[model samples]
Target: MKISIITVCYNSEATIEKTLKSVESQSYPNVEYIVVDGNSKDNTVQLIQQYNSIITKWVSEPDKGLYDAMNKGIEMATGDLVGILNSDDTFYDEMVLQQVANFHKQNNIQASVGNITQHNEEGKTVRKYSAANWNPEKLRIGFMPAHPALFIKRELFDKYGKYALDFKIGADYELITRFFLKEKISWKYSEITTTAMLIGGVSSSGYESYKLITKEIAKALNRNNISFSYTKIFLRGFWKLVSFLKKK
Candidate 1:
């Protein structure tokens, strides 16, 4: 099966090369690697150009934001499965996409979710985010499969629609809710560690981001007609703490 991997970036000069190389090193040969840049001022586009042979398609232009760029990539995708790899994240190993393809082929599921390891600046793993226990019900508590580690069939977007632009930080959460809960998409969990993420991204920043995401999570739930409370969402912090303590 052909898998399409989209990397949405913006002034990602500091780390985009690693992300590019991660895809270039994939053992899966049918990957349609697409990169969408938000008209970066840095050399991010130049770095992407260096890997033009591996990249199936690339576009550097202005965009609304991260989710908007992702939407553009989704629209441009033409593969059986579609996934997003952030500009600062890399696949855990060369076999990740191959593993994902094997899982989907064997299980015949519409989507697959895997694990992610968060790393510090020193390149040490700090936390393991697993989707093994994730289910539709967990959305009420603000839990979700790691976005970078989740891959869905391209047609799902055509059927259910793309990410909601109304959210600043919770668009991913909202889209997951709509797909796994409201629409009831079939998915399976793969135990592979798909992506190795950096410590500080839009959602992983700090207390202030925590507050914003909590509020946005509430908004996402309400928008999807899912019953939830801020207290329940805040309770997810305990799970985050547990993940950090169980770092491998």
Candidate 2:
């Protein structure tokens, strides 16, 4: 089965090369590697040009934001399965896509979710996020499998919908919640570390981000008509702290 991997980036020169090389080195051959750039002012486009041979398609232009660029990439995908890899993240190993393909071939599911390790600039592991214990009910608490580690069927976007452009930080959460909880799509969890994410993304930065995401998450649940309480959402922080401490 063909797999399409999309990397959405902007001004990621310092880290984009590693992300590019990781995709280029994947053992899976039938990969449609697409990169969408938000008209970066840095040499990010130049770096993308250097890997033109490996990248199936790339576009550098202005976009609304991260989710908008991701929507553009999803529109360009022709493979059966689609995945998003952020500019600051890399697959855990060369076999990740191959494993994803194998898992889907054997499982008869619509989507696959895997684990992810978050690391600091020093390449030290900060926390490990796993989907092994994830359930649709967890959406009420703003808990989800790592977005970057999720490989989903492309047609699901057409059937359910694409990322909601209305959200600033909770679009991914909203989309996943819509599929797994609201729509009840079939999915399986694989115990593979798919993405190694670098810290300092917009959502991982600080207190203001946490507050914004919590509010947007609440908005997402309400929009989907899913019953939830701020008490449950705020409790997710304690779970996250537990996960981090376990990693330590």
Candidate 3:
């Protein structure tokens, strides 16, 4: 099956090259790579243009925000499966997509989720995120599959819809909650790290963004008709803190 991977970016000249190289080096032959740039003021577009021959499609223009750029990339995807790889993240290895495709096709599933490692700008891993397995009920406690490590059948988006533009930070959480909890879609989880993410991403930028993400996640869960409380949110946050400390 052909898999289409989308990378969204803006003013990402420093890290875009690494992301592009990782996508380009994927061993999966039928992979389609698309890059959606938000009219970067930096040399990010010029750097992206250098790989024009390999990139399936690319566009550099102003977008409403990250989720909007992602929607544009998803709209351009023509493959059987679609995945989003943020500009600040790279695949764990060249075989990441190959494994995703093999496992997905072998099981005949609608979607796939894998593991991820959060790293510093120096490329040192800071925290690792992985679910023991796929559990829809875990949504009640703020657990979610690593967003960047997720690949869904293109038809799923056509059915459940894309990321909600209304959600500024936690749209991925909202979409995953909608799919697994509300719609009860079956997904295959591979115990493998698919993406190595840089830590200073949109949601994790600072204390204010973290608070906003937590609030947005609560909003997402509540809107999905899932019962979640501040207690559960803090319970989840406590474990994340423990994980970070243990990792450090």
| Candidates in order: C-alpha RMSD to true structure | 1.7, 1.4, 1.9
Write out the backbone clash pairs for model 3. none
lDDT of 2 by residue, 46-125 (tens): 99999998899999999999999999999999999999999989999999999999999999999988999999999999
Superior by TM-score: candidate 1 or candidate 2 = 2
lDDT of 1 by residue, 97-190 (tens): 9999999999988998899999998899988888888898999988888999899999999999999998998899999999998889998888
Quick one: best TM-score, which candidate? 2
- Report lDDT per candidate: 0.92, 0.93, 0.87
Best by lDDT: 2
Over all chains combined, what TM-score does candidate 2 have? 0.96
Which regions of candidate 1 fall more than 4 Å away from where they truly are?
242-248
Q: Could you give candidate 3's per-residue lDDT for residues 165-218 as a string of tens digits?
A: 999889999999998899888787778789999887777677788678778889
In terms of lDDT, model 3 sits at 0.87
- Model 1: weakest 10-residue lDDT segment is 239-248
Q: What TM-score against the true fold does each predicted structure earn?
A: 0.96, 0.96, 0.94
- Cα shift from native, residue 122, model 3 (Å): 1.6
